[model samples]
Target: MTLASGLTLTVVLALVSVVALVMRPRGTSTVDFYLAGQRVGVATNAWAICGDYFSAASFLGVAAAVYATGLDGAWYAVGFAAGFVPVLLFVAAPLRRFGEFSIPDFLGRRLGSERVRLVAVGVVQLVILSYLVPQTVGSGITWELLVGQGVAGLSPYATGIVVSTAVVAALVSFGGMRGTTWTQAVQFLLLLGALLWLAATVIGEGFHYGDAVEQISTAPLGNPAPDGGLATEPNALHPGEPAVFGEPGARYDVLGQIALMVTLAMGTAGLPHVMNRYFTSPTGSAARTTTVWVLCLAGVFYAVAVMLGTAAREIVPGAVADNPWLDELTVDGVLTVPEHALPVLGRIYGGDAGLGVVAAGALIAVLSTIAGLLLAAAASWGHDVYERHLNPRATQRQAVRAGRITTLVTAGTAAGIGLVLRPEAFAASTPSIVATMVTWAFAVAGSALTPVFLLSIWWRRTTAAGAVAGMTTGVVVVIAMLTAGTVADGSPWPDLLLAPTLLAAPLTTVVTVVVSRSTAPPPDVERSWLIMHGTAADRHTQALARLVLAESRRRRREVRRARR
Candidate 1:
């Protein structure tokens, strides 16, 4: 790495460490450790949520997708941004109103069954592991490009995975959710700022976005072939036609587009890490407001990503003549690894310093996301599994300790998995493997957890047996389809298999309803609904906060009078 790049990365990591240490939980209270004492404000939580939500997938993968597939790649950004809508409309308020430490805790309590909790815990862990691996993979990819060297006798990729996981594991274990919250919020701002800076720099260099898109659309879409050469991808929608940069058929057809969007949208509601953030909100109303801010922020971030991707498509080829280093990274003016789009653009526009900024943003994205996933895993294994089932009378300190241990184990496991799975092995199959892998996680959550989660909230008749049955069916069907898709490559049903949420989610819902009809509902369904849908808890929390603020103000006034 260049001196500027190394210094930039070091500074960013230092800032993150300082923030985590400064915001570490103050007590042994489980609530404080896991949910930040339920005191995080809406705006801060929203930024942290954005940090958690926009993983390496958003920072690198989305731009890479747009760089490779053009219009089809832009859909990844759209779907990602749209995913929050369901959370805002159906999930945020109710989920916070019925506050709990994790998804499994909420479901287990709502359904009044240990069996349900255990099953949900299993599904949640699967989701977290799936999500965690991608963040590690992204870190590895960034390290491969940024540092270009490994430490401790490891390859650059492996080194990246190990270092990132270790640093983030330590942060989460020490800081818990409170420390993580502040760090994530800061990380997200830095990420946004990096993108904005790159955008302005690019646009200032006479890059007309509209003209660029129109100009780039004139040629057939080309990517690196398996044989280390450029090849034009055939249009899936228009059988004999060549795919173009501004068109849709470069990647997905109509069904594929819809399926991908639906999967991502529904998956947001079921994501354990993201949903857990809602529990940190002071009130249900604040959670709802947080979602609003998240939507607005995410929309801006993705829009810029899409624009930058387009700019890269138009700008990179012309600049390749000047930068000799670009030869190996590109084939016939097209990037071999789509994820390198933003970093490459950074180098082209601002040299090593610019590359450092974007690369640091990418690493921060991975770090922030991994922290959230680790905390979510800790909540599941430590709180839901160890404390609740293994030792019901466990002290708060013990539970918190268990959570820290879980964080380390989970991070280690994910790093191992990331090492085993090489991005180059699957690069030929998708525009951005990091983005695609994350979408699979989304598919699992959407299919297995979201349908059941939504039903348990909206349908009183959703019995524990029904939920178990639905979750099992969703997991089975999604896995089966994904496995079949891998084995049956080039099949006409690739879209359906790749994004099985459309099929799996509906099927899971049907199974849930069918099983629920035959089984008895929870006895406390009315009470659960009152807690979930009712606004009384929100009002109560708001009143308490106002009272506390008023009392503080009165005390300050008295102190001032005494001084006079």
Candidate 2:
């Protein structure tokens, strides 16, 4: 059965590669490679946006978090869905309108400073790498479960990390953004379809969502003990009390709540991979429209994810108890590995095929995200750094080659880091390490880039120095606090430092405001402001008038020639 599932995974990866090959850029220009020549339409870009945004964290991590923490875990989903709101209202259209190949490129040109561009490239790479590692971890987890074997003494998890990274790196190098965009859009449908089918099947099997929540609520959430044999442990949200499912505070404190939401919501706007896709839209208005569609699909995806998590809370334990082989995976009523909740439920309901579909969706989530991340990395390194600084006179082919090489290097680095982390070793009853790691990336991006990004767009006073200061403050505070929290042993510091956006974001904002007041604005501020905020309709009208005037001039020239 595992072999059969592995075969399914192979076929899916091959198909995606073929799709990338078909959509591969026909030209060698950076525009063609980085932005798909800015030709993608609204609907396709929306799906690709979903594929980019809904990584392993959203697909498997969210459900697993909910399974472990009850309604408290659903905060991840809520934060994720709510994140798109800020993107739509603030960043999407204007970002595309002021578009470049990547965020670093935009900030560099906007600020009129090469230093600002270089600094942004460093931050964007950090954000991308932070985001990429979790997807690789997720692929390994899915592979370990579905394949149940490894090659040449390597762990199945390690094999998965290598294979998934290699495949996506090839796709980005071969297909570039155009190929990756098409594949991502299609893969997202596969992801959404898989989630919907499983959710529907379980509910139809007399699994009451309300009852599942109520039953779990009556007892404190207890997860399988870390010792891994037969012991079980209680994961109480309140030290001595059972946590309820339909409410807040089960997984977060008030500070945690505010920090998580702010980080997730604002973080969406600053995600390098996510924002890079906006440049692919054919028009600024199309980018805005694409975000609306993303919001719709994301709402559906996460809502179904929450329901499936609740279903797992009811189903997997019972199913495991009836089967001897499941003992290693679950102890008593608790799952040893909370991340397996979705796949375990798939097997329980629709048998092997269900398991394969669900498992493949997990890999697809990883693949789609890795493709976008790799592309973002390429843009940052190749366009933002290499082309901008090292090779101003380089040819299109040379730039594309540089980007491909960067993609491979970035993919390898992420895979190497992921293997080192071995995320499975630290899994627990609470939001698993994979989910928590993702929040770190979001927190840093939000605290550092989001505030400065938004201020640069809306405020006329924002300067290059301010942008750099804000981002630097954010990066330093987030990394320092998260490191201290990880090493420290305590309640208040860990909780607050773990989700530090509440503290770090304000600090970043202050630095940005103070620095901007002291520094002068970019010299092209008036023109840049017009470009960023001009109505899409105005551009459309202007383009149409230009075309009409050109045609009229051509007609007059023909008449004069005929008269002569």
Best by TM-score: 1
lDDT to native, each model? 0.93, 0.86
**Tens-digit per-residue lDDT, 66-176, candidate 1:** 998999999899999999998998999988888899999999999999999999999999999989998999999999999999998999999999999999999999999
Candidate 1 C-alpha error for residue 321, in Å: 1.2
Worst 10 residues of 2 by lDDT: 229-238
Q: Which candidate is the best by lDDT?
A: 1
Q: What does the lDDT read for residue 524 in candidate 2?
A: 88
The TM-score that candidate 1 achieves is 0.95
How many pairs of residues in model 2 come into backbone collision?
0
Candidate 2: tens digits of C-alpha lDDT, residues 469-514? 9999999999988888777766464667887888898999999999
Per-model TM-score, in order, reads 0.95, 0.93
Off by over 4 Å in 2: 1-3, 228-247, 536-564
